[model samples]
Target: MEEFTIINENNEFKKGKVISVFNISNSNREIVLFSSEDFDSENANLQIAYLNIDADGYNYISQIDDEKVLKEAMYIVKDMIEVINNG
Candidate 1:
């Protein structure tokens, strides 16, 4: 898994290991799942972050707060699981 650094709105920094990546169909956007003690010491939750990948392969991280986007992401992940299991 790749490592990632997160800079919150308060200018605080956190480090974590990337769990997985999912590309949204027909879009340049992707969601990366990662985990860090900075989020929760017990690691009770899985956190997700979004980014936009440009044509040149550059990516810019952007926080996602929209419910519809999140629901779509969840469905994408579910579909991925189905593919893996059926394979």
Candidate 2:
């Protein structure tokens, strides 16, 4: 699976693999990241949303919500994989 990561506005760590990606009914793209550790279902949903923002090629949206820290950290770690792939 592919991987990518991003630092949340609050500066936390999130790590996960790109389990899958697909478009919703509206054609909006969505990405999923499965956390490397255990977390509640709510946290999982937040992580999905946060990482989506990070991976959508909008690298300049400042100030992600505080609840998204774990998700962000996961994405940032996954992003390291992307860096490695490119290099």
Top-scoring candidate (TM-score): 1
lDDT of 1 by residue, 1-87 (tens): 266676666786667676788777644677986665465455433666796667898765667787777788877777776898998
In model 1, the number of clashes is: 0
Candidate 1 overall Cα lDDT vs. reference? Answer: 0.69
| Every model: Cα RMSD to truth | 4.1, 12.5
Model 2 spans > 4 angstroms off: 28-30, 33-46, 49-87
Candidate 1 lDDT for residue 65: 80
On the 0 to 100 scale, the lDDT of residue 7 in model 2 is: 52
Query: What's the TM-score of each model vs. the native?
Result: 0.54, 0.33
